[model samples]
Each structure stands twice: as C-alpha cells, then as structure tokens.
Target: MAARTRAIVPDRSAGIKPLNYNFEVKPPAFITFEGLDGCGKTTQIERLAGYLRSRGEPVMVTREPGGTGIGERIREVVLGQQPAPAAELALMCASRAQSVEEIIRPGLAAGAWVLCDRFHDATEAYQGGGRGFDREAIAALHRVLCGDLQPNLTLILDLDPRLALARARRLPAASRFEAESEVFFARVAAVYREIAAREPWRCRLIPAEGTIDEVAGRVREAVDDVD
Candidate 1:
C-alpha cells in the first residue's frame, strides 16, 4: 500500500490579514493610552479595542517598547535594567522607531484602528518629567524618529501616583519604573496632565478611579466623536 499523504491548512482566523498596499480607505485612527504604571492603561486599551471591534471596525492593538520583535528586546532592557536617563530615552526612541516602521504605520496604512498602549508621550512623562530630561530634546528626537506620526487620540488615564504605584506593586513582577519612589510617579503624572493641557485637541484626560466598566465608559466617550 502507498503511504498516505496529508495537506496542511493555514489558520486564516488568527492574526491580521496581509496588507493592502494600495489601500484607498480614509486613514484609520491611531489611538494611544497614556498613564502611570498601573493606571488601567492595559485594561482600558483592550476594552476600547473590543468595543471598536464590536462595531465592525478593523482594530489592531499594539504597545510601545514591545510592539515588534526588536522593540520587545529593548523593552526587557529598559524595564528590567533601569538604564541611565539618556540611555533609557534612546532605547525607548529606538523601540518606537522600529514599531512605527514595522507595526504601526503598516497597520494604519491597511486601514485598521491601531490602539497603542503607550507612545512617545510616555517618554515625555517618564524621561522628561520623571528623569529630568529636557522636553525639547525629547520632542526633537521624536520628530526625527517618528517623523510627524502622532496619535489621533491620546486617552490619558489620570490617577494618583500613590494609588497607581500601589496597584502596580501588587503585580507579580515589578518593573524598574514601578520601583521608583512616589515622587517620580508624581512628576510623571504631572507631565501627563501637561501634555493633555498643551494638546487639548489631541489628548483627553480621563479620570481613572472607578470600576472597569465605568472607566471604560469614559474611555468610550472620549473617542466617540473622534471620527
């Protein structure tokens, strides 16, 4: 008897479909979630993604500092090793550059709602405010690396640093940033607020103290009119 032959079927249900280089749809929205370590960014981002998908929208969820293969490796270094301020900023920008070219730009080009957990604003908060780096320098770097790519909507989950830090510490593994003192987080939070104020057209400051559903409701409202 002849040996039996089998054919493998590809799993088309998972992962995004191949990019349509000639995609002609109106540009998709690129939204980013910004906040302190445990201010519910991860939770709200997923909730927003689900809500968008339920509306028959094409959504792609990604995170900064770990969105791509290269970014993930750099994320490990920046989160675990606690490099110097300048080095940390550099690593973050490097990751952002890779993510923009590898994941974000392509996803947007393909007409998908790109939901990012964090973006360049995180660097402005963490490095500029928390680490005392110059905001102008960070902005210059962002212009070079990201090149005018800005989120259509930045939902900043505002919460007390003390509470956010406590929530963060409850997680199984604490990151280098999580271990910083409350003062550091306060500075970060302040910077986030500043970003919201300075860029009211692009950033929305959402109060982050509530049940998941309640916070998610606010998140939804923030983007309801975002087109």
Candidate 2:
C-alpha cells in the first residue's frame, strides 16, 4: 500500500492554531512555476525573485533536473535524448530527490523563500499526461522522494501550444522534451490546466500570450495573492 502523504497547502496559516504556534513568524514559502517549454516561466521567475529581493525578502532560485551537481548530469541525459517513459520519470525523480535534500529543504528551514522554475507538476504533466504514466504511481514516488515538502504556490503560464512551440524553437538547441511533438505539448498543457483545476487555491493560471511587462503584471498579482 502507498503511504499516506501530506498535502501541500498554499497558505502558511491554513492548519495552524494560535495556541500551538511556536514561532514568532511562519517559515518561508516554496513557490514553483509550471508551464509549457516556451511559456515564459523563467522570465517570470526572475522578475518575481528580483521583486522579492528588492523588498527585503530573502529568496533562492533553482530549477529541477539541474539544481545540484549530480542533478545537472541527470538533466543532460533526460533532455539530451529521447528515453523510455520509465527512464525519463526515474531521472526526474532522482533529480528532485537530490534537490530537496541538498537545497530546497534547507532553504525553507532557514526562512528563505524558494522560487523553483519547475517542480513535480512537470512530471505529472509530461510523464503522466504525455507519456501515459499512472498518476497513482507518480504520486507514490513523489511521497517517498519528497516526503511532505511541496510548493506553497504554483503559478502556471498557460499558452497556445503552437505559439509556445514557435517561441521555443527560436532558442538554442532544443532539449528532448522541447523537441517533442506539438500534440504531446498539447497533452502537457491540458494536464497543467487539470492540475490547476484540482488545486485552485495553490495553483494559478496566467495567460502567456501577452508582452513581458503585461504578463509580469499578472504574475505579480498572483504572487501578491499568495503573499
């Protein structure tokens, strides 16, 4: 049987009681960004991190499959060439496990807000939706690998797959995931929406068709809502 896992809540005060509160302040948050390859997740993450730092909030930025030295090598294999769905999923989980142990858990414990470009949501979308992996199995792996750690807020930049692919192509050499079929990306996007629908409070969907400044404004609103 799969072990029962803790659900990640967005609000810090969601389940706490005044009498049980031990800290003078709540711990920092773990915020994540999810989207298609070219949906501008990196841009928004940079903007939000800068804004947070400017406002005197200690923030740490990181990315999956490449957050740690070992994770980077795993990233190269996963993104450099096509692999079987199981291999892809395992590689992703390995990177995530290392990241949580090496970076994410420590960052939150030290009261620094963590802004990650991609988290397990990408696995759910790409491996689960696109590759037809079983969602229950994925959840079980996440529970074992990450324990109770999860994003406090997950902001997804939603965009038309056709446009997003076009934008992705203009970048340097495409990664294996980036080079996937448009139909596959459509599947990925659909799963992202489904996840947002399932967790409306923790996940916010932002249209990605607007200019940088315009999209940044929407991102700011979402962050403010969580903050």
Candidate 3:
C-alpha cells in the first residue's frame, strides 16, 4: 500500500513545533478507537490524526469493516443486510483480515502511525456482549484472523447508551446497529468498559460526554504518554 497523506492547515497558535526526526527510524504506533455508534470516535480520530500530522508524525487513518475495497463490500453487507450473529462475526473478521494485510501491516512497516476506527473490540462488544455470543470464541477468531496483531493503544470513548443511541438515530441514514435497542447498546458499552478495565496498560476508557474540544483535549493527554 502507498503512504496516505493529507494537506493539514497548520495550527500555528497551538505553539507545538513540528518534531525534527527521521520517521524511518521512529517506531510505528497502531492505535484503534472504539465506542458506541455515536460516541464521536470518527471525529476524535480525525482530530488526533491532524494533531499528530501537525507534529510531523506520519499518520494513516483507516476504519474497520471498510478500509480496503473488499472490506468495504463486506461492510455494506454486514451493516445493510444485518446478517445473523454467526455470519456477522465471520464478515467482520473477513474485513479485518483483509485490512490487516492490505492496509494496516503495510502502513506500520513503513513507520507511520496507523489509526483505525474500530477493531476486534467491536466484535467482542457487539457480538459477544450484545448478541450473546461466547467471548472465548470471539477471541479465538480474533487470534486466527488478525494473527496476534493488536493495537498499541486502544482509546474507547465511553458514553451513556441512551444519549449515544439518540445521537446515532439522528443521523440521515441509520445503520442496522443503530436500529438496535437501548438495552443492546447498554450491553455493548458494558463490554467496552470491561475491556478497558481488564487491560489498562493498552486500553483507555475516555469519557465521551463533553464538547469536541474538551474530549479532544482528554484524548491528547492520553496519547501524550504513548512512546
């Protein structure tokens, strides 16, 4: 895969100078964002990418279920068709497998900060917690499909299900997940919290209940400590 770049208007007022270093020698960071459908993961990812790029970091932003051409077709089927739980899990994994090989691994090999929108955690949350699938089975599948590849940092935006669902429903086009009941989302949220608690070294549960800038500030603080 080719290196992805974007033109970011520098934020001169931020007073953060672009780092002087050889990106080729810098260790790559794989960061994944997770949350309820409307928990602002996308916005926060974009904001964080811009912030990193401004500091002269090579950043590649991608999303699960749709990062590659094949993954995108799978995305439409999974989100639009609302496959059965078993099939849903398979499709999600398939997309992730393709992304891991086609986009993510290559980006990391090139020494870029690869930021993904969703990941296996979403499967653990939605399939295991919400749909009542076996968590162990999900983990097994993740191991096989992703082959031990894991995010260096996972920032899960935490929010109340009721509020998050309300925000999701207001979107112009609702996804199958968005049409799910509040109870379903509550379960998903619970799993996300559990994951963060279980793996504090790699996962951070960020409170997602504030202005965009406020949440971004918290995200920046969390990322600043990352090596």
Q: In lDDT terms, which candidate is top?
A: 3
Q: What is candidate 3's lDDT per residue for 1-227, written digit by digit as tens?
A: 12222233433342222222121212487889999999999999999999999988899988988999999999999989968889998999999999999999999999999999999889989988999988877877788777778787789999999999999999876798998999999999999988877665567899999999999999988787555
TM-score of each: 0.87, 0.87, 0.87
Pick out the ten consecutive residues of candidate 3 with the lowest summed lDDT.
16-25
Off by over 4 Å in 3: 1-26
> How many clashing pairs in candidate 1?
0
What is the per-residue lDDT of model 1 for residues 1-227, given as tens digits with 9 covering 90 to 100?
12122232322342212111221112377888999998999999999989988988899989978989999999899998968878988999999999999989999889998999999889989998999988777877888887878787789999999999999999887788888999999999999997777666667999999999999999988777555
lDDT of 1: 0.83
Please, what are the lDDT tens digits per residue for candidate 2 over residues 1-227? 11122344433232211111111112387888999999999999999899888888899999987889999999899988777889999999999999999999999889998999899889989898899998667867888888867687789999999999999988786676777899999999999998887666567999988899899899988777545
- Candidate 2, superposed: residue stretches over 4 Å from native: 1-27
The global Cα lDDT (0 to 1) of model 3 is: 0.84
How far does residue 212 in candidate 1 sit from its true spot (Å)? 0.6
Q: In model 1, where do residues sit more than 4 Å from their true spots?
A: 1-27
